[model samples]
Target: MTTDAADKPRAMEEEAPPGMRRVPGGAFQMGSDAHYPEERPAHRVVVDGFWMDATTVTNDQFAAFVAATGYATVAERPLDPAQYPGAQPELLVPGALVFHMTDGPVDTRDISRWWRWTPGAQWRHPHGPGSDLTGLGDHPVVHVAFEDAEAYARWAGKELPTEAEWEFAARGGLDGAEFVWGEELAPGGVHLANTWQGPFPWRNFEADGFTGTAPVASYPANGYGLHDMAGNVWQWTTDWFAARHAADPAKPCCAPQNPRGPAMEESFDPRQPQVRIPRRVVKGGSFLCAPSYCRRYRPAARHAQMVDTGMSHIGFRCIRRDPQNVQGKQKP
Candidate 1:
């Protein structure tokens, strides 16, 4: 936990990233007790105002960054067998996780039934080898690993938001609201965010008018005038993933100020001790979330993602926490 002078409110004068909105930060409830166990003991947190992109980074934006740097995303590079000692050699290829719709209802408990590691499934080739970003330039760039997003942020002179900052901005000043818009998931039978409308893994009602990623801002903005804060894609946060949130400060006066998550060693996946990759906290569910299975299209919802893996449903946005949005000057 870190704290600056909470009384001394500093106005960070800076040029925000293009298409970003400045979030005037204050105290808010950071987690949820209603949903998953990991989001328990909703705690109090305070953050300083920062500029956040109105939406996730679009494919066009990522393309521009790659063009300028000739950077290859993690999915495009061959996997090192050394990382997974006993893994099958056939599975050790350049690829990414892509969600394949099942023909009928299947056991949702095993996610491997639908999520397949398809070769050549990078950001550009979202679906597979033949797929390309021919018409989806404005859609959120998916299949981006943690390092890929960091590289893009560095190239753009920005930084990824902390879990606290991202949640604060997502809440949009509605201190304890269930959804980004309000308590109801969809008011007046309208689709508020890009989430699954039907059963999980097998069927998609497409009631939201999108089976996959929708273009940025296709949905309405939150109270802070930031779009897609609830869904469309899960955005990366800088904090390491914790099994559960820390209890709120015992004293009201000492509530965590600009708090971050646990250390890297603490974030390693317990289920796979042999694999040393750490997981970070990813906020705001994705298009794959559903009512029956994963109803995580809310401000308080969060998921842990392994730092080394890139999936088709994951994307990211950048933030500016310093007065000047210069390199190495911004805070997480």
Candidate 2:
């Protein structure tokens, strides 16, 4: 299990939060030089020991939260015209980004070819109005905006993980290995994570036994016994989106301790200066990721997702940095 000293199970007297795994605090190289530019300049990072959810928040779990608190997800709430100037009133209604397979191979650059902003595409109606939780109770909840995730985390007495903490835990003690499992993406032709098998945006080979989202823990857990850290669905992090992790290792005397992302103002997409929406770093790619297209199913890989928006492939998990967040106190 490659258990680290800090992560090793303590005495039974220690109160471990249920449905979470303890990730030991330590320093390790972060980001990747071979992958996307955002993950470039692979630098060092150190994080404190924290308890992270074993799997992404599932539909059933989120339903319980909603049932108890009467919470309404972002996708269920109407958009403010003030926030989105020049937008049609009809378009401003409640909706979310939903994925639909194209008829055949088309221009992969245009994401709109496969994604539709369908009305009533909230967590309860994942596939739009006609869709319901039905058999997907075990699958990770989707169409949850950052605030929605934050609300759930607050309700559960937890917080979303920082990008570095998530990446560190996702590494599962393997450090800079290419894949979560190891160097080989799939050893012996085994599908380690639930990712797109065929070409994305058009077809899915379903080699991993799932065309869409798979149930949590459908694949083998990483070394830390954390599941769905690589694929199944992208997970939200607390860090704001930054173009690059340009921290020069040569300049820093030591690895940054629990490094955070750029400021909220700096998180806006430079391309869309007209829009003021901020972006957050979402780790772990989703089932839609394919080698033909987005190869982001690595521990170091990250994507900039708008804070006010959620897609069919986006979900999240929570972490407790201190015992006080859950239990009364930490045991000596």
Off by over 4 Å in 1: 1-16, 269-276, 324-332
Over 132-205, each residue of candidate 1 has an lDDT whose tens digit, in order, gives 99999999999999999999999998889888899989988788999999889989999989999888888898
Whole-structure CA lDDT of model 2: 0.86
lDDT of 1 at 294: 92
| Root-mean-square deviation of candidate 1 | 3.3
Once fitted onto the true fold, the runs of candidate 2 whose alpha carbons sit more than 4 angstroms away are 1-13, 249-253, 270-274, 323-332
TM-score against native, each model:
0.93, 0.93
Clashing pairs in 1: none
lDDT of 1: 0.86
Residue range 128-209, candidate 2, lDDT tens digits = 9988989999999999999999999989998888898899999988988998999987799999999998877788888889
